[model samples]
Structures are given as structure tokens and as C-alpha cells.
Target: MTAFLSRNLAARASMLASLIFLTACAALPRSGPNKPEIYDGAVERGGDAQVIFVNDHVTRASNFTPAYGFSNSFRNASAVGADEIRAGDVLGLSIWENVDDGLLTSLGASSSQLQQIQVDSGGYIFVPYAGRVRAAGSTPDQLRQVITTRLSEQTPDPQVTVTRVAGDGATVSVLGKVVGQGVYPIERPTRSLSAMLAKAGGVAIEPEIAVVTVKRGNSTGKVWLTDLYAGASNDIALRPGDIILVEEDQRSFTALGALGGQTRVPLGNEMISAIEAIAMVGGLNSNLADPTGVFVLRDEPEAVASKVLGKPVYGSQRMAYVLDLTRPNGLFLARDFYIRDGDTVYVTEAPMAQWRKRIGAVVGTIGSVNSVQNLAN
Candidate 1:
């Protein structure tokens, strides 16, 4: 009777444990949803996001790679002369006459020096006898000719020389991520975008991730700092009243789920592949991550979405691209796949991981029941 009672109590305990396990199955701890759950969420009617498998075909169809490069306006622009004069410029004029008592010269001096002769807003400068010669549009040598001619009518063989002292007329403001930040004059050595950056003591950020922007009036252009030497066309001419900004690349993507790290990763190169992005976050969590359920989520532009789905899509569509690393060409596909800014790279939890949690929970419950029965005995 004792043995039979013991058997009955054991069976009752087993039954109770099974009931508790079933009731608490949904409450098990998990890092994130498993593969099946993600699929179900994607396929539901009016789903929040669509899931598409990553393959060579899909990679080729989705052509939404964004990069920084100058437009035609910047590429086609011609370099301006460094010595070109403009209004608001300060000039230094020297005048010498053959006669000792020359026009506007003292009895003992044969040459006269005019320091800091500022060009007026009307692009003209007043000379003793030249009478408001237009200096803003003329180069130093050109202005010299005009002044010499005007003075020669009154004074025989007047020698004139014009020198640019300083000016705010033809200057560019360099700001952001540069060794030096200030208003720089566009001279012969610093007339182009690349040259002007050097004048500002080069970019302070890494060249691989530096972005250079030039704004002139209503137009603006941008390009990677490394591309400045990639081609001559990218070395655009600098214009007066231009604003040049050198900054670190602002493009980044977020990594979530079962990965070594969960954070936003910045682009370290001009272009980065999906594999590179995964590595940036320390790859997948080997013990808990589902190798077959990696996903890249992004909002696809209308044109790219239409091509990717082979159907017309209106506006920006939410897309989730799946990558199965277990497939034969999975790693290769990932290597070629490109990651865009504002993308979410997620890896689902392995199914076995959840099962392990459930097993642990059931084992703990059964141990508790055994302890209670022993106390009652």
C-alpha cells in the first residue's frame, strides 16, 4: 500500500508539472522573436513591413546605392583667375614721375605711395589724376595701365603699379571638421575646392569618411574628400561668397537582435556591403542567433521598390530583406549586397534557444514540486 501510494503521488506530481509547463510556455524569456514569428508578422494582411529574400536577382534589381559626388555644374565649372579683382578690395598704388615735383608728389620726392586704397561699391577707385578708374573688374596690371594713361596726359611718363593688399570680396568661409576654420582668400594656389581645403589645413576627419560640401548662392554640391583626387573633374573651381563645409560622414545603420553588439554603426568607407555591416556590429551571436534568419529592414524608394518587387509601388515602401547564411551562395550574396543608411540589420533568435529556456523553466518547476512533497512526508 505504501509503494502504490508513492507511485500515485509521483504520477500526480508529473501531471501537475506538465500542466504548469503548458500554461507558462508563452511566458518564457527570449531575446527576440524566432524566424517563424518574423515571417508570420511579415505575411499578415496590411503588414507593417514586407520580407524579401536576398539573392543575386534581388540585389541586382534593387539599385538604390547612394554616394557623394559633384554634379555637372561643379564638374564643368572652369577655374577663375586668382588675381581677379572685385569690389571691397584694398589696393596699394605706387606712382613715380620723371619730374621731381610730379603730380601729387612733394618737391623732394619723385615717387608717391598710396596705401590702403579701397575699391568702392561701384567698382571704382579714385587716383590723384586718374579720376575714379574702375578697379574692381580689372586685374592689378590692367588697373596699372588705366592709371598710367590717365596721369600721363597731365604728367609726362607717369609710372604706376597696383598691388592687392587685402579684400573680403573674393573669399570663402571654411567651416566644420577641418584643421583650420576661417575666411580664406582664393589665390592662385587655392582657387579649386581641393586646394582650398588644403589651405584650411586639410580635413580633420578621416579621409575615407570625410564629406566636402560647397554652397554657392542657390546651388550646392557635395563629394567625398577622397574623390577629390579620384578624378580631376571632382576638383571643382572655388567661387567667391562660397561656403565650404568638411564634415564626417553622417550615414549609419542600426544593428539589433542576436548580434555581438546592438548599436548604430557608421559607414567607414564610401560603400559597405551587408557582410561588412554585420561584421561592424561584431557578427551574429553564435549560440543564440539563427544563421538562416538575418534580415535587413529599410524603407525602399518607389522606383527601387517597384524594381525589387517587379510591381508598381507608390511612395516609399517598407522592406525587409532576408539573408540565409546557411545557403550555398548565402555568404556571397551578402558580400555583394549593399547596405543603405537608416537600415536595420536584425537577426532572429534560434528556435533551440527558446526550447532551452522552456526546458530550464520546466526543470525548475518539477524540482520545486519534489521539495514540497518531501516536506509533507
Candidate 2:
């Protein structure tokens, strides 16, 4: 009877252990939500996000390719004259006369040197004999002509020269990620965007990821630093009061789940594909990664979302794009697929990996229960 009772107790313990294992399966420790869980939480079923497969058709339909180039206004802008005068400019004037006691000369000196004559806000400069002369809109030669004409009425054969001295007018403010940041004068050699960037000692960041922005008056435009030199049309003309900013590319995507590493990967080049992004994060985890369940999550713009889903979606729509690397053309599609900024790359755990964890948990529980029963006996 004792032997039969012992056998019954053992059976009961095995049953209880099975019950415990079943109960704890739901609380298994996982890196992230599995594939089915993600699908069940999609927007089509009143969830927070939508799921789509990455393929050739979807790639062609969605137009989210971002490239850097200037607009027509910025590209077609004519270069400004380097010697042109503007307000707030300082001019160095010299006047010579035939007689020593001329209008601009002294008793012993035949020439008079006027140093650092600043142009007023009204675009006029005050000369000794030639009243207020408009010097802002005119070049040095034009201003010299005006000064000579005005002084000729008082003194015969008057010679005048106007030279632009150091001033804030007709200059561009170069700031941000450049070797040298300062207000650079727009001379003949530095009249274009490329020339001005060189004048500022080039961009401090990598050329492939560098961005150049130009704010001219109320209009603003931007282009990749590499693109600036790729074509002449992108080499926009620089204007006075222009603010040129060079900065590193801010585009990046987050890598998560069963990858080799979980971190934010920057777009070091103009364009980076999904495969490249995965490789950047040290590729997938060999032990736990599900090659068929790699996903790229993004809050796609309404236009791109609409085209992707073939329906109108208002505002930004949350989308999760699945990439199955096991397919015949999966790697090719991933190579063609581009990763945008603020995107999340997730790789789900393999089914066998979760099973392995469950098996481990059950075996550990069974061993603990056997030890307790032995002690009780």
C-alpha cells in the first residue's frame, strides 16, 4: 500500500509540475514582442500601426527617396558683382588736384587722403567738396566717377579714387561645422557657394554626410556638400547677408531586437539601404534572429503612406515594413530599399529560440520539484 501511495504521489507531482510550467509560459523573458504579436497589434485591426511587405511594387509606388539639390531660384541665381558697394561699407577715398590749394588739397600737398569714410544708412558718403554722394548702389569705379564729377565744378581737373575697405556689407556669415567660421567677404574668388565654403576652410564633417544651407534674405535652400561639387547648377551664387551653415547629416535609424547590437546608426552617406543599415548595427544575431521577420518601422508621411497603402491616409501614419530575407529576391529588395530618418529596424526571435527557453524553464522547475519531494520523503 505504501508503494502504491508513493507511485500516486509521484504522478500527482508530475501533473502539478506540468500545470506550473503551462502557467509560467506566458511570462517567458523575451527580447521583444514576437512576430504574431506584432501583426496582431497592426492598425488594420484597430491597432496603433500598420504592416506592409517590402517588395518591388511597394518600392516603386512609394516615393520617399530623399536627395539633396537646390531649387530653381537658388540654382539659377546670378552671381553678385564683387566690387559692388552696399550700405555699412567703409570707403578709402583719395583726391588729387592740379593746384596745391585745390578744393580737397592743402597749400603744400596736391593730393588729399580721406581714410575710413563710412557710408551712411541712406547709402550716401560725405566728401569734403562733393556733398553727400550716393555710394551704396555703385561700384568703386562708378563712385569715383561721381566724386570727380561733383568736385570738378569747384576745382578743375579733379582726380578721385574709391576703394572698398573692410566692412560688414557685401559679406556672407559662415557658421556651423566648418574648419573656419566667420563672416567672409564676397570677393571675385568667393562669389559662389562652393568658393565660399572653400574660403571658410571647407566643411569640418565628412563630405558624404555634410549638409550646406544658405539663407538669402527671406528665402532658404539646402544641398548636400557632395552634390554641390557634383554639378555646377548646385553651386549656387552667394549673396550679401547670406547665412551659410555646414552641418553633419542628422539622419539616423534605431536598430533593435535580435541584432548583434542595439543602437542608433547614422546615415554616413547620401543614401543607405536597409541591408546596409542592418550591417552597420553588426548584422543579425545568429542564435535568436528570425530572418523572415525583419521589420522597418516608421511614421511615414501622409503622401507616402497613401501611395503605399493605395488609400488616402491623413497626417503621419505609423507603418511597419516586413522584410523576409529568405525569399529569392529578398536581399536584392533590401539592397534597393532605402532607410529614412527616425526609422526603427527590428528583428524578431526565432521560434526555436523561444522553445529552447521554455524547455529550459520546465527542466529547471522539474529538477526543483524533484529535490523538494525527496526532502519531504
- Top candidate, metric TM-score: 2
- Best-matching candidate per lDDT: 2
Q: Give the lDDT of residue 135 in candidate 2.
A: 89
Residue 345, candidate 2: how far off, in angstroms? 1.0
Clashing pairs in 2: 43-49
Model 2: lDDT equals 0.87
Candidate 2 lDDT, 348-372, residue by residue in tens: 9999999988988899889967975
Per-candidate TM equals 0.90, 0.91
lDDT of 1 by residue, 1-377 (tens): 87777777777777887787886687876666777777776745556777899878899987478767888877887776767788888999999999977887899998999999888888888998779789887889999998999998999998888899548788899999999999998888888988899888998888988888899889888888888879888899888899999988888999999899999998755577888888988999987899898998899999998899888978888888999999999999999888988989999888888888888888888897787567445
Report every candidate's CA lDDT.
0.85, 0.87
RMSD of 1: 3.6
